[model samples]
Target: MQPTFQNIQEAAQRIAPLIHRTPVLSSESVNHISGAQLFFKCENFQKAGAFKMRGAANAVLSLSDEEAARGVATHSSGNHGQALAKAAQSRGIKAYIVMPETAPSVKKKAVAGYGAEIIMCKPTLQAREDTLAEVVKRTGAEFIHPYNDERVICGQGTAAMELIEDTTALDIVMAPVGGGGLLSGTAITTHAMLPQAQVIAGEPQGADDAYRSLQAGKILPSESPNTIADGLLTSLGTKTFPIIQELVSEIITVSDEEIMAALRLIWERMKIIIEPSCAVPLAAVLQQKEKFAGKKIGIILTGGNVDLEALLSKF
Candidate 1:
């Protein structure tokens, strides 16, 4: 069955002790600059350095005993791979991760450090999937998708639950959109609990599939994304696209420069490090300040798995 609020709640209960309840921070400086009352859900501090842990742990733990023994396999760019590797290790299950050849070395080392086997592939989604398929077929491992599963979505929804619980009556909640796992789950949970809360998604301008898809009223595939927000390069998944289309109030786009600026702002003002992908929502707010002025807004700082050297060189 598709993930619902009930399913997400159950997942939250199941994974509560395993994951951090990460703090919700407020910044008057950010509010003053953007003219919006901002509540930041600091998922960059989450375990595995991203919100991916919620779903990865849920998917790993939900597996049948037989499936667990067979182990788990998946494809990810970085954060999800590390999350799955760590979650699988916690359950004493071996994990096989397929990552792009061009994925950040820092992330690749983290996944390997978690004791998961790594298989490198070309930078295409198709290549990653094919490699994962072969690995799963060879080892008879359970396939744990990075985003396209009900259990994964349910796990991701918990982030939204915690955000709303921490602060009440938000005018809107914004999350970065990649495969749509986080946004889809946020939509389900937020709509069920805070029906008045509008859930918006932020996408990079260079990889604006989610924004274009929402605007066109159909699934729009990204064509060779060239964005610096490496984590937001993927198109929406089949399961997540329909849910996002139904539940998200809007999908906004932010340029790569704007994303970098937002990233720098978070680091300088909040004293927190966030990757470009994680800064998309904050970038949106900065770019469209008038629309969010004087309103209570919640933004998810999705992850912090940036390569410091690359970031430094860029600036």
Candidate 2:
């Protein structure tokens, strides 16, 4: 089922008590550098340390008593797994998260901390899916896809809805496209609430399937995605791809170096700790300053679930 504006609204009300109404912030230095007014919806501060919580809460809450009793399951690299775990804990239900072995230790620890059983698999997407399938078949858990499900998409839309409500006169709403869940939600909400605003997505150059898919007019699988933005390594899902294709105006690709620079800028100047995935949108803005010059842009800072020990050691 396609998620609509009303679904997003209902999701907002449904998950209201379950998640934080994260603050919208701006950095003057960032604005000056980008030559645009950048308003960041800081989902990094959200419960579970990511905006995925909004969708996870909605999906879990929307379940019937019988369905909830069966529990929920999904395959995730990090944020979504932690989100589903947190949401399931809130509802006092079981959650089985199938995670890639390559996912950051911090994210895996967070998922486990939320009381979900983590099943580790090979780093390949195929392995993650196969593991999840086996777990679901054995456990009778309802598979709540990380990005492709209608409930999850509607739940994701709430973040952008709140962003539009708390801010004024946004010319564009931007998010980093991983499986396209957040971007799809952002597009649906922006088109509904602020029809004049364009919805754009930022993707890592190394993981440019979303960009390639848009150009090819189809959903393309992501293979050998090599980037620091671990959260964005997945390809666009079936449900998310259609919504993004219809509503998103563009998909911008930025290199790893640019993403790192943007990440550092946000940390040094804005004093916010963001993971590399969260910096992709800002990297896009900085990479193409002329396109966004003098515009009011709203960027969703997706998550802050960085492996600090591993990251800091490089510096």
lDDT of all predictions: 0.92, 0.94
Candidate 1: segments with Cα more than 4 A from true spot: none
Query: Candidate 1, residue 23: CA error in Å?
Result: 0.3
Ten contiguous residues with the weakest lDDT in model 1: 26-35
**Residue-wise lDDT of candidate 1 within 1-315, one digit each (tens)?**
568899999999999877999999987787898889999999989999999999999999999999999999999989999999999999999999999999899999999999999999999878998998899989999998888899899999999999999997898988999999999999999999889989988899899998998889888899988898999888888999989989999988999999889888889889988888988998999999988988899888888888998879999
lDDT of 2 by residue, 174-257 (tens): 999999889999999999999999999999999999999999999889989999888899899999999989999999999999
* RMSD, every candidate, angstroms: 0.8, 0.8
* Counted clashes in each candidate structure: 0, 0
Q: Which 10-residue span in candidate 2 carries the lowest summed lDDT?
A: 306-315
TM-score of 1: 0.98
lDDT of 1 at 87: 96
Model 2: clashing residue pairs? none
